[model samples]
Target: MVWGLRLFPRAGGVDELALDRALSAVDGPVRAAFALQLLEGLDESGVRELLAEAAVADPVGAMRRAARLGRPDRAGAQAMLRSGEFDPCTVQTRPSDLLRRRHRVRAAAVAAALCVVAGGLAVAVEQGARGGGEERSPAGVFAPVLDPAELMRTAAERWADTSRVDFTAWPARGGRTDDDGLLGRALRAWAEPSESVRVSTTPGTASVPPAEPPQLLFADEVDGAAVVLFHDSADRVVRYAEPLSGAGGAAIDFARTDDADVTTGAAVVVSRTADGARFLLAPWIAESTTRDLLAPDTPGRPLEVGPDGVTAEVPRPGAGGACETWPVLQLRSSERIVEKHAFLLTDLGELAPTHLTYMPKPGRGTPARQPREATGPDALVAWARTACSLRTLAGSGVRSVNNWAFAEQKLPEGGASADWVCTRADTWRGPGRVLVQFLAPAASPADPATVIADRDDTALCSKFGQHVLAGTHWRADSGRWYVLGAGSRAVTGIRATGEVRGAAGGPTLAVRAPRDADVELTASLREGGTLTAVH
Candidate 1:
């Protein structure tokens, strides 16, 4: 497996025949990851040499070959990649500052799904595109829990409607149980959730935020006319600036202009429903820009509408370097309304009135830690006696599916920054789930930012989990969070001790709940107090 090659040396211990079989069923990162085992024999010094050469290699194929064999040749490196064995369409940049940045596990996967299907496939056509972006875990936050009872559910007949088919080819979908994954594995450590009825939890009533009226955010158009609207059931929209767009009902027409970018200077219109649905209306971008719909449309039309009203796209996205959340306006042709979605426009470059972008952040930029040759985890050594959840398993199942990427980052006592490369994820298993792996970096004077790559010395999640198994070592807090898995079909958390860390360096709270109970833990090395929870 690519992972085996990255961790252990190619000296032995891997089953080449098994990997070859795996290659047939999977592609993208998983494939490339498994291919890593072949390169493991090299020492730290040898691996470093290969990365250097691979960096400046001329032919892409050469890189693939070397990366595959661990010799690190550019041609070989690209070859392994070209095999469609990995995420071919992954947005690529030098693996420079990757170690320093914190990853947004779920966000990266979502964005990758979009980029891969579009970007990767395009490359395949020419060379053909093969595959796919941020993750944010703001500090001083509480863990989130899923209250299935709260999820709206209809009769059993409604559940049956989930499929267009009457029977499934494989097993039934159920709870998660995979230790390699952050959440999948954690489920085993917690308790079971409860089966309850639906009752919307208002922030005030649930002890989340104070109560208020749910607010409308945006709406999107479907096909041509149907509009989909989004709202904050607890009126949390204004607090987070969740974008709202669909405003669907628009009949925009072109005036036989040669170019598509022209727009009229006509005034824009917006409306909202009492139930928290919003609408945005405006004359075509061409009309708003040139003040003449009849003008040439070659260059591009300006976004005559934005957040603050529509002065050349108001609400001004955001400050530089930070992620700028924007609305993805899916139009029908040059100016027709289709539907819309939220995205982060990395930069406010020259995007057309209808074009979209995503959030950006400030920084000189850090690179991801380039995963070196490694052996597959010990789990791959043995297969599960029975595949528990079809939902949790992929076409190839866990071991054969996602070939793990490994690296180590040491946040020493004094603390130094290190870079870690994170590719956007193409798929996310659990809903609203964020899997975190506590890395045990080898002792080094170099701050995290300077740690470019992982030496074979780093350990696996289970191996290094001891650091956190007792509890988070750094200063932190606790709150109501949830865990989902089958061992018990529930997840329970507790008020363990927390430490000091983050921008404020204060005691933070943490929480985990399995439908039946809530576990809250808060600790501050500085300001200490025992947390008490009543069953």
Candidate 2:
């Protein structure tokens, strides 16, 4: 009926389409609040309480936002409520009628029992006449045609001689392999996962199914739950898990793997087991160590890795908290590289684990010469923790991330200079993108950086790229206005001509110009080339 109203409606002159548009303009929580209050006829407090149960941060605020958008027609809603009215009390019944109905039900049950007994006797006599009658084993009567043991042996042999460090080479672990139902379910999930199944692949990893059946990686029990890990293809890692007691539906998850993961030397998939969270390490991982990225100087804590490449239960980070401690995994791969991975337990959603990799401006630096050295600059690590990069790019198949300080300019009226940084996320497939941030001078190390722009594909911060960062006015302490312009790192000097007469060298230019003037700026690069600004 509610959908009918939406499809064709003029309820007290309220256009349901317009009302829907207004509600859709708000966030999800706010939209939910509207549905509960208006359609479900819930009170404001009840709606707020339900929203709180759903983990909404500001349930009352959501309700307030819904109310402010204007309410629909109460009279029309009341009329709809009246339209479906029915009274149970209007029907009549008697004890005499109930007794007759009970008698009829009892007679039907006896007749069914008699018919079953006669049919069984006839079947027994027929079997006796044919040959020696024998009862079949009930346990094996409906066994599945596929053998779990045979399946495992075949999959294992397929990858025994392979040189790749993928799921095929990974040892099969998990105590639940004997459970044919669980194994079959996992295999079916791999071939054709349900639409509701959650899938997360890092930027460059493949998300599609393999051309053939996936190879088994692990089929053992982890902390009381049956977990089956496999690979859809060489580059795709898939995991399926369910309760050992068969109490809940199975959950299937997918992640991509590549040479970058191998070169970094270790990849991990964070899975939620029955007891807690467990880190599922790749086959090539020799050892797993973790440390608090928030406290970089702290000594690493080694986690015991089982023969099956599963780590003991690790503490799960609280979702949405101002990250108190960023957990960094130093997974030592068989190739002897300490791969750094940082996990963020964000409120956004479940994400496939991505490593914290650093790419220095090609010739500027290498990925840390020391085995114990951290991946990127200290400032970049700080930015990753405080800024929204991790939260935003968690599902972008980010193979690695590098923070580049593109340009820095001393504020015209400030005590310190502001840094313009571009954070590039190199995905698996090939091309990468960047996030541009205008980090104001920090009074302390704890100050958070602000994101100025996030460009999906741009060469604005790369080497040999030529583009002016378009000028913006900054007001001084004494109320004087100055126009500031910055260019790429290759830019050697900047000249402001019309309405602003100033020249400055080294990427940044500042001139005391009118706020609304038609300013013309030109940038000179080290390659003896000059280019005019275009915004």
Candidate 3:
């Protein structure tokens, strides 16, 4: 005689099938309450009063429904009610027969209260009903609440403890059971106490900067290994990094653990493959308990590659032993190409390393590419002459080159690492002066030359600069130039006066140019790579 089922004497007359069907039709909470009342041997009045407290409307009708369906065994009902471990408040709600009749409103309030009191049991029942019991958590148990600091500290200790033990004789590969057995044995060995391993805990308020509030720092700097854990306010190990160290003069390999979990944290282990190339070992932790606490293991998944390079899924433990997935970026490189490092771009735009190993296949043997020649002030001046030819300045009667000045400046794109050459040229037409200035990459030749130019009516004392009225600015890339300033006047024509040459100390065009003439210039780099112009 199971709970919720009626027990019958072995006389074949009872229609147990029909009775079971009727009992199954009742709501879980209602059925549970009814079972409890039957088991408790409540009288008619007591039953009715219990129903009202449970917010079950029409107590008589509910009982009649159950009776018409089947006779539930008192002992079985009592066992079922006890197995569920319902809270006292849930089993006995507020005493009010009047409220039971108006169950629509009262039941709603009672259901809310039951949800709070019953904890996971109520949730399991509701989910079980909806999902045919497939979605229910374990009966009579609530989700685990984790302490982040304790979890990290425990993890750090486990890591330190395991590294010192020697597992050199373990079999490398075997069947599933054998593999699991080997891993378990190895982990046990690692967990053994060792004199070489050391553990230290620091208060959150110590001089060390805190990563977040309510944190605890743990460091396991063993003889041959080191680990640092930063437990955040939520008690989750938010950050874990391996410190660089020297052992036997070998380069130190660093690894990072994924989000901390009770059972095991994902770690990227750096080790060399048999072929002498570096490879990363990302081991999935097996499910185990520590000090009677459950540490669930995470399932292994295929590693993914994205634009940011290799990505490993790190499990972030949430409240109640649940975990969220966080993808961490890793570095990638080819034997022929330079290794490129990647950083974890956090929400605040800060970059941190995922600290995983990457080994790309070696490329075919080929000669290394030569670096480009450095573009200097002379190269920029030469570019300017070709850009500002007499034909390009035709209408203004600009016959000769003028004063030139060059300076090294910073460009917008490359920051301080790359240099830009700023060149300025001064020309004049009698009472008017025209100034041309341009910025070009100083480390490499601008594929196509560009210039920023302005004109001023010297007679009116106007200064020709970047902000001149209708000043023209153009960008040249790959031997083509186009106006960048929309309102500026276009170059009407351009023709090269001579071979492009750098101007060191040249005659001022302002002293040699004709008066009352406006310059109209057009310029373009020709197909042969020479600067051509028409004016």
Candidate 4:
């Protein structure tokens, strides 16, 4: 709350005395009512969430209002009340419900009441959702609510050790990045580890600073591994390096839809691949491009993100192509777009992200109008599927990116730890299964038995079973398959299911493979089923 005094000062009126009075009565419905008045200083979504989640006493009534009037709008809520649902004076619910809807509204009842009593004074908690633009001083800024990307990144770093980093120095040309979004941020923590990783548009470079500067967003280590924050003018990483982590860190990656001009300031972008790939580790600055990335015929500027959540104009991608605005996700090995649902990372510190359904799609999308922030990965996936009419088989971008599925034993995974990544079309038609057992684990002593594979439905047989070990059965069905016997422990981590429909006959589908292994799939249709192997 460094810049708190400046950013939050009662947006409507409460000029100090009016504020203090409200601080005393914070709690229950009265507290929420006051907090509602003070919400003007907060982000739009944060306010909406507060009303939706908080126990307003008449929850069922409020929900009815929400259904009829949409949400929080007094007119709508009043209209809904006509149907005999609520009274802001009596909106209440169970404590357990508070837990379930915590993300919606979990403001301290006491604090909210006090703030309201103080006129329109916003409590500090009310101003918690600020992102970028509003702050004048670095200290004055508030970290945007814990977004899905940052939270996931933190989790990934913790479980897989991507956080262990070195802050020996900052790169000369490195600095804060403008390329940022609800997904994640990029920063350069130290001097480029090697000269080969260095680059400069002006053709000359210099040594970076050596100090624990405030500008450095964060620096940490996990399992002895290191990651440093890079900025446009202050980071030490001299050049962007490939293979950010030798082997262990290959699993962690970052991306967002960057269909904008890459030529100037910061912009968020999703990637095609991430393993050992070169990226804008820190922030930098340069000229600005006047082109929009969404135009199909537009030749856009090529820019990259910097450390302080900024972007810098750079030359075109080495292999030139029109940089169109897409809702993409980029990893070292590949990149894809958020074509389906826009999943906003939550501040709850949990893994379950929320999907915002703004457009027409399957039963999943919600037709709610929302804030204009750009889209995220979930949205892009759905979009790609619908646009391309991708079937049970892999989609175009996934095939090109060469997505893989790791062995069944991957741990602490979710956009980190180099685990198997498979983005399936939610509405695929046939049976989908990853090969549980490679056909020849004994014959070939190469790698694990798990390989990225699709079930080969050789329209012939139906009940296919093989004994991996006595009592452990590998069964395949026309629609479902089991890696272990019926009573076996659930394979929680193994990405076992995929859609499998196409002409009944077996089709060699795309799936990750353990270095060198043979995978087998079995399925049935009107023509029965058969088993087959893939290298």
Better of 2 and 3 by lDDT: 2
Per-residue accuracy of model 2 over 1-535 as CA lDDT, tens digit each: 2321222223323444455445544678877876687667899889988998998876754675566444456454334333322122333322335446678889999999999999999878867886756653222233322224435333433333455544455555555556667677666555556775544444345555455545566677766567777654466667777766866566776655555335332444546733346766766666677665555445669888876667776654433325455555666555332344333222122234544533223123333221112344554345444444454554446655555655667787656776665666656555666666566655554355655455555554444343435455666768888877776656778889887789998778888887687678888977787876534
How many Å off is the CA of 262 in candidate 3?
21
In terms of lDDT, model 1 sits at: 0.24
**TM-scores, all models, native as reference:** 0.19, 0.59, 0.16, 0.20
Best by lDDT: 2
lDDT of 4 by residue, 1-535 (tens): 3321222222222323333333332224333443343333444354456655763443322222223222235453334333322223443232334344545455666667876877544434344555423533221233322221221122212212222222212222222122232012222212222333322211012334223332333333222233333322232222221233554322222111112111111222111222211122212222222222122133334435443323332222111112222222221100121223221111000011111121211121333222222233333332322221111122111111111121122111121211122222111112223222232112222222222233232211112322111001232323233232110011111122323221212221223323223333433322333322221
Model 4 lDDT, full chain set: 0.25
lDDT (tens digit, per residue) of candidate 3 on 375-419: 223332333233322212212212122323222223222333211
Question: Candidate 3, which ten residues in sequence have the lowest lDDT sum?
Answer: 287-296
Candidate 1 residue-wise lDDT, 60-179, digit = tens = 222232333333343444444444334435433233334433455566888889998998666556442322112222111122222111112223232223332111111111121111
lDDT of 3: 0.28
Best by TM-score: 2
TM-score of 3: 0.16
> What are the per-model numbers of colliding residue pairs?
143, 12, 24, 143
In model 2, the runs with Cα more than 4 Å from the true position are: 1-169, 176-181, 192-209, 258-260, 263-265, 273-276, 297-299, 314-323, 335-351, 359-388, 408-418, 428-433, 457-485, 495-503, 511-524, 527-535
Write the candidate numbers in order of decreasing TM-score: 2, 4, 1, 3
Model 1 CA deviation exceeding 4 Å by range: 1-18, 21-40, 56-342, 345-535
